[model samples]
Target chain A: MATRAPKTKRGTARRETLLRSAERVIGEKGFAAASIADITRDCGAALGTFYIYFTSKEDVFRELVGMMGSLTRRMMTEAVQDAPNRLEAERLGLRAFLAFVAERPSLYRIVEEARFVDPDAYRAYFTGFASAYATHLEKAVAKGDIRPGDAEVRAWALMGMAKSLGDRFVMAAEKPDLDRVTDEAFAMIRDGLAPGGAA
Target chain B: MATRAPKTKRGTARRETLLRSAERVIGEKGFAAASIADITRDCGAALGTFYIYFTSKEDVFRELVGMMGSLTRRMMTEAVQDAPNRLEAERLGLRAFLAFVAERPSLYRIVEEARFVDPDAYRAYFTGFASAYATHLEKAVAKGDIRPGDAEVRAWALMGMAKSLGDRFVMAAEKPDLDRVTDEAFAMIRDGLAPGGAA
Candidate 1:
């Protein structure tokens, strides 16, 4: 006879527990060094249990990427929707991104490691987010709020800048003032790329 | 007493051979995975001779970063100096950067792996290059050739963009149209940041 499945709530709780444990292990030991036994032991689960939820470490990594991406998108969407204008939306987006990275430095390492684990997965994760941001940028450009240009490229460039800045500042062992860096970066973007003279 | 230096140039040549061999091995198998025996064997040199010039595998990695940095700076300097105008200079600099990366994808991996091997070394390597580029950018900004802003931050942003672009195109196993991407990136920078739509 076939075995019964676990209750939905219990399965999700176990999954969340395992994911948290995996993140910590991967963060401390790196993706390559962290083993299934280590993650299961940390999560207080059995080795077989990990296989039930994640086929391998790579699956857990992909899930991490998806989870972070979804969280980031949700936060950014909320912030953008709250903004009254394009410039405000841009500022809000930058702040939200920095804030997210500052809160979860390990996530940065996970994302960085993903590039090596699977380039295709990395491209998919990045392109998905870039497309979402580009949609917002296109609206701003259409409204004459920002300069007319390739919104997709601009979105990627902006995201790249933010990621670089965060990697340098927020993820540093000795963190800097995120608020200051965010303001400085946003000012550069606004004054550097705005349609008119030095917005 | 310290052993007298070899009178013949053979010692220096042997050292160079070992360094190159180490680079190749590390490039293929990663720094952590590449054994000293593998490197020495690749060079057809005695394993003991490897220790004569370098303290350890990590020392070889240190030297690799320095070599790559100097090579990059030289190529970028030449490219920029040869260009007649700011836009041309930007294009030349980018083209140089991409070409250098395309020719040595292994060096790219080594530099990134340095973060895991030695964080301080990684910071020093990046700071050295960033400062060099920033100085060049500052000079251009002083002459009103480029946009008015924090030249250092702008330099970092530009470098970051190039790095992200390179990771996507040049370092991929399946290389993209690097020349076209370089041109497009330079064009975007010029048009997006030029003083008066001159680009």
Candidate 2:
């Protein structure tokens, strides 16, 4: 579906409203169950107004997934921008990621659901993230800020760790403690589970 | 959907065939797109015969998810049974998981799809596995087999690592090298990425 870019400020604001509403509705009801009418209704817009911004439900869902990808990348970048080193960056990045999941859980679930709703977009999201992550690891290795290993493997492994921790601690927890979870996971990431471990 | 257990040997065999077929059909086409007729057709069973064991497509999908949970637990247990220490068990277990993903990519996708199709089953499956994993970590900590940390957090983090690695290396890769992926990730899980890392 072809999504049109709004020309005027009002149109831009209206499109943003529809996108936000679509995120909430699609995130709650999922892609298959959520309807265009539901999205418009949720945003207090007429049914035809949805067509002004998006062509179909699939188009809006894909846009949401794309939005999530860029949002996550931007969040992580800003979160870790001031980290002193690669290891600190990992800690900062993981903490930021968990907090992001806690704050915008609807968008998180929507991105996950994209695995089935839009497989290509889903693959692109993670693949793009992983590639950028691998580059960072490579830089960290060159600087000797962290141990040398397979950057690609390490990047994916760390991403997995953060993703799982976010799901368990933030998404699934009754009372999420971002600080405690971040500290423990960061400890493991830095020193690992090796015997006579570093504190 | 209420699924009936097969009482006779022939009934059990037939049920198993239907289940195996369901795993493939659902895994390939996904739960929403896959139908009972496709499952029956794949298994060479009559349309009416599906009702012999499973009441509906949802029933069969749930059964497959359940089967994956038990099968994974069994596989992990057997894979790590002979490990001399917790660290070794981690390596063996990860290696086994990647191999399992490569062997049964269908069932792997099926379990993931369960997250949406049957939310309760999906939660139960991961919660059960994470609990068992946490227990193992507790034991390992008590034995001084690895450095002590939050068992639950570690369990989920490690599970996430293995899962993401499986997705990237085994599921997404056209040419997967389970041993190398296992080795690299195991190194991180063991010694971490601290400067002057122990390899």
The lDDT for every candidate, in the order shown, is 0.74, 0.92
How much is B27 displaced in model 1, in angstroms? 2.9
Off by over 4 Å in 1: A1-7, A35-52, A83-88, A131-145, A148-155, A173-175, A193-196, B1-8, B37-52, B82-89, B139-143, B173-179, B191-199
| Residue A87, candidate 2: C-alpha displacement in angstroms | 0.4
Q: Against the true structure, whose DockQ is highest?
A: 2
lDDT tens digits, residues A6-37, model 1? 46998978888888998888877888789989
Stretches > 4 Å off in candidate 2: none
Tens digits of lDDT, candidate 2, A1-199 = 6798999999999999999999999888888889999999998999999898888888998999999999999999999999999999999999999999999999999988888889999999999999999999999989999888899999889888898898889988999999999999988899888888465
Supply every candidate's count of residue pairs whose N, Cα or C atoms clash at under 3 angstroms.
0, 0
Give the alpha carbon lDDT tens digit for every residue of B79-130 in model 2.
9999999999999999999999999999999888887889999989999999
State which docking tier applies to candidate 1: acceptable
